[model samples]
Target: MRRAPRRRGPLSTVVGIVLLALMLFPVYWMVNASLQPTGNTLRGGWFPLRPDLGGYATALRDQGRNLVTSLVVALGSVLLSLALAAPAAYALARFRLRGTDLVLLGILITQTVPGIVVANALYGAYADLGLLNSCLGLILADSTAGVPFAIVLLHTSMRSIPGEIVEAAQLDGAGRLRVLRSVVLPLSRNALITAAVFTFLFTWGDLLFALTLTTTGTVRPVTLGVYQYIGAHTNQWNAVMATTVLAAVPAAVLLVVAQRFVTTAATDGALR
Candidate 1:
């Protein structure tokens, strides 16, 4: 028998709505600011009585190229991280190797290390390898954020797959690679999507790597572009806010589209 969903009391409902409103007020205010005249946003009204598109026009004109660069770098990071992470996760999950717990602990530790430390270490290596300021360099740097996290998440998900199922595949004369490709990946689809979504989000918003690794205007992510935009257009708050809104769109859209998978990926492991 199915359990009925829990119902909230009036007070609980009111509290939930108030909390949601508090969280969303800034986003509402950003849109309100973006629609104001291109002058001082501080003088703008609480609501935009005269909405202006000029801010959006100016933002796209200035930062469109940088937006594309961010998209490219984000997609590249997702692909590289997944390619490297998936196999490693599969091996660590299925194979009962020696000292596996220590290795997993080490991977977990990387998450605690500050991103600045990694960027500083990669700086000299990037310079020597001629990767600085290049899309490839940014992709590689961003993948550092993605790979370890992906491995840990994917490992947990893959481990939940039944051993009998994996052994059955092997019994059918399937090799390790084949089982991973045909069976494991198909079963772990939700976890894979969750990993990719997070990786893309992290790479899309990365600023530290963009600032540290690149010196010239030849390449820049939207995050760096926005930082520079703020420096250059301090007086034009509407344009600045417009650029921020644009920067936030991809992330918002991605989250809405992938909400189901992320929810499923979390529950799937626990239930298994």
Candidate 2:
């Protein structure tokens, strides 16, 4: 027998809508502010009945390069973090190595350290290695934020894979590397996507490394661009808000596009 889907009551639905509206009001406010004329955002009305697109034009003209820099760094960080984390996660999950618990504990401990501390330390190293003000430096620094968490996420998911499955692969004359590449990775797609999404978001929104590692306008990320914009004591509030909205678009789009995969990754451990 099929079970009927449970439907929410009218009052519950109404409350949910109200809560959703409340949560999104800030976003609405940002859009409203962005559409207002320069220097008049504070006096602007709630809705943009006569929307002015000047702010968007200004933002695109001034911050377009920063947006591209952010995208490159974020994407690079995701690739590097996943490459390093996935293999470590798989090894830790499948092998009974000595001090594995200690290694896991250390990974967890890295999360407790403040990001500014990491940035400060990397600043000197980057300067010495001539990596300062470079996209590679930004990617390497930001990967720290994602690698540890990704390792944990992938390890937990990989552990739930049945022993028989791995053993069967080995019995079929598959080498360890082949088994991992052909079977393990294919089965952990959800977890990989989840980790990649989070890593991209972390790197895209990162400001510490972007600020500390770069000293010039040549390599500024959007976050640093926003910081500099507000610091300049300018009255162009609309441009500021527009840039912010643009910066937030990637995270929102990723969540929307990968909504199903993210939900499945959270609930499902691994391939059955």
Best by TM-score: 1
Error of 1 at 227 (Å): 0.6
Report residue 76 deviation for candidate 2 (angstroms): 0.2
TM-scores for every candidate against the unseen true structure: 0.96, 0.93
lDDT of 1 at 258: 98
Model 1: per-residue Cα lDDT over 1-272, one tens digit each: 99999988899989999999999999999999999998999999999999998999999999999999999999999999999999999999999899888999999999999999999999999999999999999999999999999999999999989999999999999999999999999999999999999999999989999999999888989899999998899999999899899999999999999999999998987787
Candidate 1 is scored at a TM of 0.96
**Ten residues in sequence with the least summed lDDT for candidate 1:** 263-272
Residue pairs in collision within model 2: none
lDDT of each: 0.95, 0.92
- What stretches of model 2 exceed 4 Å from their correct place? 1-10, 269-272
